[model samples]
Each structure stands twice: as structure tokens, then as C-alpha cells.
Target: MKMKRKWTPSTRFMLIILYFEFIKETITVPCPASLHTANDVKRCPRNKLEWNARAARLNCSSINQTCVDPSLFEYHCVLNKEGNQLLEVCAPSKHIHEQKCTEFNSFGKLIQASVINCSDALITCPDAYRSTEMYKYQACYDVVYQSTRNEEAHCSSRSTEGKSHLGIAVGLNGEVKCCSGYKWSNRTRLCEKCTPGYTGPECAYSCIYPYYGEDCFKECDCQINLCDHQLGCTPVYWFNNCPHQPEYEEPAFTNTWKQRRDFR
Candidate 1:
């Protein structure tokens, strides 16, 4: 049999480096032209295209003409998945707020947008609905390019902060605390589903009384205005006066162990 190759510390380090390099390539690489859907989009064209035949057909000029020209590099049309509306906004590759507007069909609009550096992307749910996922966007600094002899070091960033829990802190500046309605889960590393009796962004607001559970779907069967978010209904004993248990007191110290045993 051939000898088994042993892994050295240097070899392991090199492997890790290669793995990261591969991921970087994956993220930086442009999405295939054929892949048009915005579902979990990750990459965009590195350079602006001279002309977009697609834009001529889209005819977004009346609403926002900038939606089509790929040469703009930062402009891309965000097609509403539920509707036909297209929203044109500035979201650079490094500043992309992923998973925020998954409901909207990105329509391959992964090109960077024109926005101030390190800006937050706010995404709110529609009326009568609260989001269990999607949090306020926060940008974190990352080295875009390492220093070289001729060029100085440069940095890039992304608006997608860790954890989708609302109102959580971004980056290393402070503790990552989930909102009241949300609990941080170590396994998923994201704020999970709504907790009992709580819903809304960062768990800031509670479900109306008599309605509890996620999105206030569960109805309470208890008395009026007595329902709890998690427990459903308030206990009847809480309103009634119950007999109090007599306080226990030790018997007078017995003169001897036998006396104490007899008293017991």
C-alpha cells in the first residue's frame, strides 16, 4: 500500500487560505447571464456593459430610465415579485443588503448602487404583517485590497450584518443582543422565530391582548382582557382569594434528643 500523507500545520494553513480564496472567487464572480432570478443573489457583473438589449425592452424610462443601463454600474431594477413595480436604488456589491427584500424579484440587478459609504438599508414588512427574518442593515469594514508596493491598502464593506434579528447591534462594537420577541440561536447564528407572546421588529411590541403567538394568530380563551401572549389565559386563582397556608415554626427546643424525637 502507498504511504499515507500526514497533514502539517503549514499544510493546514495553506488549505484554509485556498478555501477562503475559493469563496472570495465565488462571491466576486459575476452571476451567469442566463441566471436571471434574484433568489439569494450573490454576485454581479464586474464591469458595466456597453449596452443592454434587455433595457430597451423593459421601457422603464417613464418610471425610472436608469433601471436599464448596465453601463451605470450601480443602477439595477428591483422587480416587485408580488407586483410589477420596479424600484431603482443604489446598492453597491459590497453594500448589498441580502435577504432583506427577497420578496422582491431582483431580476439580476446585483450591480452596485449609488449610495453613501456604509449606509443602512431599511426594509419593512407590509401592513398587518411582521417579519421574523430580515433585520436593519449595518455595514462592516473588510479589506477590499491588500497593500502592494505600488498601491495602498483599500477596504470594502457589506451592509448585511450578522443575525437577522431586529434591533441587534452590528459589528464588534457592542454585544449582539436579540430583541424581546426574538431569541438568539447559536446553531443558526440568527435570531430565530418569534417567541411566545411576542412579535414585531426586535420584539419591540407585543401582540394585542387575547391574541398571542407568532403574528398574533393564536386566540385566547380566557376572560376578556385577561389573556396572556404566551400562556393564553390568566389563571382563575389569580383573581380569587385562596386560603393561606399556616406558617411553620419549630417547636420549643427539646431538652434531650429523646424529647425531640417524641415531639416529632
Candidate 2:
């Protein structure tokens, strides 16, 4: 019943980036040759156009220059403790042959914030992180994967998050909760109805007899398919309110009875 912060070291909370952008950063996709923030990357003075900043990718990554190899343009995205703001994008020193990436741009007065040493999953979920907006979980995965290739190590699912939301995937929408097992649909950005053949909190249960679909919202016709037990019994001939109700009635024989009685 205790609440926990979804971030470790607190400073990592600054990296709430987009999903695609986060993936690009983790893979070290070099910045484009031309940038709105910095021009002339296409014609670098030192052939160092690969030394690009992460902020350019904060919104967009469209560019002409091919992404440089991480071996060639490795950099540490530093964070300045100056109120949890991004410090600098410092690349490998031409002198240091080893690959110990420096964090802060200057690495002199600034403290080295670690990209490792913490699992974001262990942290408490922020409003934005809980909903997966701004690629919250993916950002954590990027950092954790750097230390250990095991992606599951930093997965949010491993954490016991706001279960009180009752499996409801958070988002900007006012939707409070959803059934268990089913997550918020990335495309729709909403907790869609349970998938066909699944129902209940998180959509863990399967559709019985008739209901089917991503959320089991569809109703089945009793002809070839059986009705769902929840919909009540659908006897074989019960269509259109029993259209043949009078067909099996016994016929009256008053004329024959009268004739037979007169003869007797």
C-alpha cells in the first residue's frame, strides 16, 4: 500500500523523450548533417559532424547525413545538477583511446551522472511515465540495456506499479482504469475493449461460446456460432420470437365428431 517514486537518482526523470527518439539515442544514431539548432553540420570544420546534440532529436531527427558509427562518434549525454537540466553532449576525447564515455560536457566542475547504476523500473511512476507518453519506459530500457543486454531487467512490467488503477493503462484521457492483462493500445492511445476471446480486468479471461475480437465486444449469431453464456440461452429455433409458434397446434374436428354422433 506504500507508494514509490518510479525513477532512480531523480535526475533520470529528465529523459522523458519520445519512443523513436529514445531508441535512436540508445543506438547512437548520429545527428543529421543539417540542424535547425546548429547549421553547417553538413560542412563540418573537423569532419566531426557526427558530434551532434540530443536536443535536436527532442522533436525531430530528419537529416541527410548518414548516421555515424558509435565507435567513431561516441558521446556521453551529460546532465548538469543545475536544477536537473541537460549539461552537454561530450564526445570521446581524441587523446583518451579507451571507451570510458564522459558524462558532463566539461567533466571538470560538473558531476558525472551515470547512465548505469540504476533501474528505472525500480523507481516510482510519474504521471507521464505511467501512461507511456514521451517514451518513459523506453528511456529507462535504453539506460538499463547499456549495462546489461537483458531488456527484461529494466521493464516496467517487472515493477509493481499502480495496481490500484486496476490494470488501467494511464494516458491523457480521463479513462481511469481497464481490465487486467490488456495494456493501453499504442496506436489508439486508449485502453481498447478486450481482444476477441478475452474479457474482464486486463482482458485475462477468454470469450466463452460467442463473443470474440480484440476485446470480445462482438456478438455472435446462433446459427453457426453459439451465443455467449453471458447473453443467456439461445435455443436453436428461437429466432424472430419463434416465428413458427402456431405451426404445431392440434386441429379441431367438430364436423367429423358431429357426423359420427348423428350416425350413432
Q: Which ranges in model 1 have alpha carbons more than 4 Å from their true place?
A: 1-188, 237-264
Q: Please state the error at residue 243 of candidate 2 in Å.
A: 54
lDDT of 2 by residue, 118-186 (tens): 233444224211110112223433342233223212223211334322234332343344434355566
Worst 10 residues of 2 by lDDT: 39-48
lDDT per residue as tens, model 1, 111-195: 3222222224233322211111112211111111111111211111211263233434332333345433454566766665576
lDDT of 2 at 165: 25
Q: Which stretches of candidate 2 lie over 4 Å from their true place?
A: 1-94, 105-107, 110-163, 166-264
Give the worst 10-residue stretch by lDDT in candidate 1: 141-150
